[model samples]
Target chain A: MKKLINDVDAILGESLAGFARAHGDLVSLSQAPLFVRRRAVTPAGQVALISGGGSGHEPLHAGFVGRGMLHAACPGQVFTSPTPDQMLAAAEAVDSGAGVLFIVKNYEGDVMNFEMAAEMAPCATARVLTNDDVAVENSSYTTGRRGVAGTVVVEKMLGAAAETGMDLATLQALGERVNGATRSMGCALTSCTVPAAGGPTFEIGEAEMEMGVGIHGEPGRRRVALASASAIVEEMMGAILADLGAAKGEDVLLLVNGFGATPLMELYLVYDEAARRVEAAGLTVARSLVGNWCTSLDMAGCSLTVTRLDAETTGLWDAPVHTPALRWGC
Target chain B: MSNTLVLRLIEGMAGTIESHADQLTRLDQAIGDGDHGINMARGFKELAAQKAAIAALPLGEALKKAGMTLVMKVGGASGPLYGTLFIDMGKATPEAAPTLADLSVMLDAGIRGVKARGKAEVGMKTMLDVLCPVADTLRSLVDQNETDGLDERIIAAAGHALHRTTDMVAKRGRASFLGERSKGHLDPGACSSALLIGAVVGVLAPSSAR
Candidate 1:
């Protein structure tokens, strides 16, 4: 309720405008049907990578929209999915002669809106649905596992491949493979408030934490008393490792992503714990990323994602890339 | 129905949604992301603003335009789902006045569109829970040649359907993430859908009918 904003209705536009201005060198904003496209034109034959979701997750789809990442990102209202018009327009704006690929999280709203845009897109388009959260039970009776922080991993690897002029189909296939190999789980110490809602999405006791929390502050698997950081990481890593089933000695990429309010100090501490767990399991932690790359508004939490990597994927992970939130070997 | 009647129905639905926005948010807070009320109120407010323009069009066109407005402005699972409902219903409606049978067909189409858009079914603890029952009630009424107290019957059916959602577990949307925790709460989408249906029918019926 006590957010620093002029008006609730203008929060998204004003923040987007500021972001566009601050990062004008890397991105440009379109007003009518809102979307952020890379400042530089997409290569003549390179596939365009577009991904988006609700707005509260800072520097996610938008901050990732630069060189060697997403070509464009369509942002919706806080915790709300973007409409189809935004996606379609973004596709038309960025799509080169090559087709477009949509990196969609497996939320109902995100999936439905992106599906509508894909159907209405003028050019060939495909989607990579990320459902890497291992907390939820995947079944025909449910919507399957919710896509959490692993989306960044999928986007980064696919962006690298697309930058190398991979065709749309190849990029889509690579994205699916990366997503399949990834698993994530999160725990929240506190709930974040959506601007429009004017209060926390869910209330938690002072000493309680929601295990397996989604990015949007949805209730997780269960709420339990707070425990030590190492204990939390043990349980989270256990779920992720059990789901991934990576072989011993396999090189794995570990991403300890902050859910907005958690600082880098704590994130690094989490990364340390997570990496130790992975190593203890007899897996090699070849690549590691720790930051607030994918966040839920201001929720105090973090998610750990483990991706089983091969030589090809490891090479892609090290590829040159420059974006607002991520930069390496540029 | 005439354009004026359609406009009245829009106003009624918008008014009802705005008034109950807080309740919807409360319901969602229990099992979902707690934005349903805010999202629904914003969409209907926009729809109300365009009532004059939308009312100028024929019934089918007006419904389609209204649906598109909701889709563009709502920006959540509810937006596309509700938008599909109205859009498909509009597609099934004739330009001229639709009879009871035609209305039944329109409702059925709208329900089908919602199902396809959300990949959901009647028992998924979504708007479909309320909408499907209302559609069946309308169909049965048409088949039985019952016209008296039609609005009351439809409203009662929707109310019952909405209440039924309280015990159901969510299998779709953000609420599904809660698993068994999602039970014992009314689905916000179903609550809003029932409210709109009741509002629209309330406007069409005379006071004596109630």
Candidate 2:
């Protein structure tokens, strides 16, 4: 219940105002606070990349808005999906005539609203859905696999592809290819507290951990007695690699994502174990991201994502990207 | 039956929902993300803000305006679901005074709209659990040519349906993630749906007494 805030009601507005102020050079907030887009105008023939969902997952759709990344992100309230109107507005604002590409998560609300928006938008729009969580299928908020940290992979690959002058269909195919190659699994040491709820979502005993937890704290496999850090990482990574059908000599991009409250030291430990485990499996770790790129408020946990990469995807991953949370070769 | 009466009825419904916001939020916190109350309150507040303009329109137009406002202002699953109900009801309604049969048709349209938008069916532990029963009762009464205490009958049907949802497991929305854990808690959407029907009764009972 106790945290830094002016008021519960002002959370979205104030947070966005702060975000816009901090990254004015790279991004601009629309008047509605529904979306944030790149500050500069998009080229007339370039495909626009747009992605969004609920607001609790910080540094996601919004923070990824910058050069060589998303052109717009439509954020809803905490754990809620943005309405179609927001998407329509963002599509109008950022579309440069080539077309708009929507990178959506598989949550029911997100899918419903985005589907409605696509029908309402003025410009031609194509969509790519991220359903990379290897944990539970048909969980509380979605019909298929929950989209987790692999969304960052989808956004990055498609963002780079769009910037490279790829047409809408080509970018969508690339996005699907990356998503098909990616798998992620998450585990939580403790539940997160949603601000509006004013309490932790669930209580875990000191000796228990929630394996395969969804990003929104939806129930996972089952609560089991906590294990050593290395042991947990191995099990999570094993699930992902098995699901992804990864094999020896395969090159992969690794992502060790914090579920908000996890420390860098722990994430690095997770990364060490994850990278070592995959290497032990004879897979080469070519690119890695270890941080809170996708979060669930202040939950205490982390997830592992492995994307089996082709040469083209690796090149796109290495492309220049400048955003508030990420910067490379700008 | 007047357009002014319809406007007052909508205003009354907004007031009822606003008063119960905290109760709905509490119910949601037990099994789902706890923002149903805040989202619904914000949406109704938006409708209240434009009350003067809504009142100036005919009944069907006013309802449509209210529905659009909720869709724009409320950012969640409930927003689109509830907004679709009102919008569909408006589409089925006539601009002038409507009879009991006409009300039944409007309710049927609204309930169907919710079903299409949410892709939820009966027994899914959603607002449909409350609204479908009420709409069915109204339709049956109209078909049987029974008009006595029709408003009270619809209200009772909605109340019964709302209470029944606590015994069922959620098969849709955030609470569905809880699986069996979602049982024993009242569905927040169902509760709000009952309140909407109660709001209608509030407007009709007093007018009938006069």
Best by lDDT: 1
lDDT string for model 1 (B7-119, tens) is 89889999999999999988987888777898899999999999999999889888899998998888888888889899999999986799999999999999899999998
Q: Tens digit of lDDT per residue, candidate 1, span A1-330? A: 788999988999999999999999999999879999999998799999999998888888899998888999999988789999999999999999798999998888899889878877998999999999998889998888888888999988999999999998889899999999999999999999888767887789999999998898877788999999999999999999998999998999999999999999999999999999999999999999999988999999899999999998998899988988889998
Q: What is the interface RMSD of each candidate, in Å?
A: 1.1, 2.7
**Tens digit per residue, CA lDDT, model 2, A3-43:** 78888878888999999999999999985747999998988
Candidate 2 lDDT tens digits, B1-210: 665776678788889889999999889878777878888899888888888888788777877888888877776788788888988998998866888889899989988998888888999889999999998999999999998888778778988999999998888887876778899998999999998788878788764321
Standalone chain B TM-score for every prediction: 0.97, 0.95
TM-score of chain A of each: 0.99, 0.98
The true-versus-predicted C-alpha distance at residue A190 of model 1, in Å, is 2.4
TM-score of chain A, model 1? 0.99
Candidate 1 chain B: worst 10 consecutive residues by lDDT?
A: B201-210
DockQ list for all candidates:
0.72, 0.41
Query: What docking tier does model 2 reach?
Result: acceptable
What's the C-alpha lDDT at position A240 in model 1?
A: 94
Residue A207 in candidate 1 has what lDDT? 97
TM-score of each: 0.95, 0.94
